[model samples]
Target: MFFKIFIFLLFFIQSSYAHELRPAIANLNIYEEDNITNATLSIRLNLEAIIAEVDINHSNTKESKQSDKYESLRNMSAVELLEKFNSKIKNLQNKIYLISTNSNYNLVLLNIDIPGVGNTNVARDTIVDFDIQNIKDEDLKFFWDKNLGSIILRVNSPNNEDLYSKLIATGKKSDWFNPKNKKEVDFFDNIRSYTHLGFKHIIPKGLDHILFVLALFLLTPKIKPLLLQVSIFTLAHTITLFLGVLNLIKIPSVIVEPIIALSICFIAIENLFTENIKKTRPYIIFIFGLLHGLGFAGILNEIGISDGLFISSLISFNVGVELGQISVIFLSYVFIALLFQKRLWYRNKVTRPLSLIIASIGLYWFIQRLFF
Candidate 1:
């Protein structure tokens, strides 16, 4: 019966997150100096998606002979357009921040610090990087979001003028390049930016992390054990995140990503079969957390961090991640405990199908990560 249910869920989840070719490109580049840093970022927003969303929202206006697509877009609300652009930016930022935090860097935002901007209608490049002196091994992994077609980090030598030139050249190659007033960006003022990035990293975009926590909750559903498990998972992942980012312990994404996917599957399957939450679950989660941490580190390796403040960056990033995880747990209990815990109909009809479905999706991710 369980197997049948699991198989059905496999079908359901595959249909839900079917991989679509993304419409945007994002990349991160890092270069270190004794105490100064430079990071060049490129994000090409999916103009199609943006336009589609706008068209859908404001379709009541009558068709006119003067309707030029570009002009129409320009006429759209600045608030609405900025909101959409910011939403996409925030998601990319969250993912990048998570990767950076895992990689052991506290990425502070110096300013808007973009290279160029002329008109508001056209998509503009948003470039930001920091200068630091204390480089740590934990701050070297590269992170990219395959789903979103966004690149997070590309690190280069601190004083390598050639590398810097290459980054600029590549930006030019993209037809949408808009070079504007060059402005100096201060790295220290980015504390607030770092905090915002960290908060979003854990809360909204950390779906995989949230799912991991949920799997734990469904299995234990008790206070003491749940707290212990959360702590262990957090500690274990943080330790390995530092190690992996620092390059002391290196694991290929070919190995790490698939296993991370498998961890999700394992937790979900266990929820169905295991009655007693083992005292050793924390230890096991710690081991798997280590793997996930490596995966997280890979993300930061892609985004450049200033070498001067590497340790503090690491601490701050990890702290943000911990806070994000805790928020997930609190919210899950608040919503799920109230909605489903008291209802047997959900426990059986809904929970069974839902878990099986989610697990199947996890299984699919496992295979894709391993084989493809």
Candidate 2:
């Protein structure tokens, strides 16, 4: 019966990947010369998601649903996809809105290049080059329509050699990007933005991190033990996260990802045979936290942190992540520990069972990530 139940849970967890959320990335490069402004925006996103967002009939379909037409689009060669986009360039342009302080300028479709075939596992980039009259004197803001997934925007200003990046959600407009605007973000505002980034990473997005933290939570029934472990974990990760962002310490995802999965399995499995936190557990957690911190840095590096705002952004993001971690701990206490910690059967029925499930998932992830 135990084996049957475990199998069922494993299968259920495997099926959950179909509903996973993926964010789109848009890299916008704009430069002005000779009174003309040229812009090249390269957007990388899942073709099926974009199709579901744009197609009238399929717009209402859930992104997880498999579509034959969408698969065909995904299989198309770069030239073929470019041709199709060229034919419907106007419609595509309308989906992304750009406005200057004084007037809205149209983005003329110059060219499109879809990635070459052979990496179906990865999202493809659609390069769109266009030009508009130089709006150096005015503020410019841009946004995409609703139903498009989260967007990471990178803006390059040639005038001052400043690079600005921000995460913009669907239907949300970006901050005004102007070459002449030399103003640095206020400390409080920097804290607010980066803190949100850090929090969002953990709450809705950081499933792996959540599992790791949960593993730590199940290690002992007492709050003191858990708090000590969490504090050490936080400190360890903070150090590596800052080092990783500064490029002083670097580890590739290929190595770090699988090790992280294994760490989750290790902690959760150890909980089955141990009732109290071991003296060595804190050290182990600290090491795992270091790995997790590198993971966090990878995320920030992807969306980017401006050179000028680096220190403030890093500190704010770390604080937000700590808040997120605390929230997770609080939720675990309310939902699990408070209700079951005192029960005679808690160890056998609650902690062991849940730890086994978590360990199984972690082991599966380890195999999948390392081999596949």
Q: Which candidate is the best by TM-score?
A: 2
Per-residue lDDT of model 2, residues 242-288, tens digit only: 99999999999999989989998999999999998888888899999
Each candidate's lDDT (Cα)? 0.53, 0.75
Model 1 clashing-pair count: 32
Score every model by TM-score.
Answer: 0.56, 0.85
Off by over 4 Å in 1: 1-158, 161-188, 343-351
Q: Candidate 2 at residue 367, lDDT?
A: 86
Find the candidate with the highest lDDT and give its number: 2
Reference-based lDDT, residue 108, model 1: 49
RMSD of 1: 13.9
What number of clashing residue pairs does each candidate have, in the order they appear?
A: 32, 0
lDDT by residue (1-372, candidate 1, tens digit) is: 767866755654343223121223344444555544445544544332333332322211112222255345444454544554454544545544323334434444433333322343233333434333344433333343433333322233434321211111111221111112112223453344344445555565455566677787776456887888888888888888788768899877888877887888787787776656777677779988888788667755554344544565566667777778888778878877667766756556545555665676678788876665
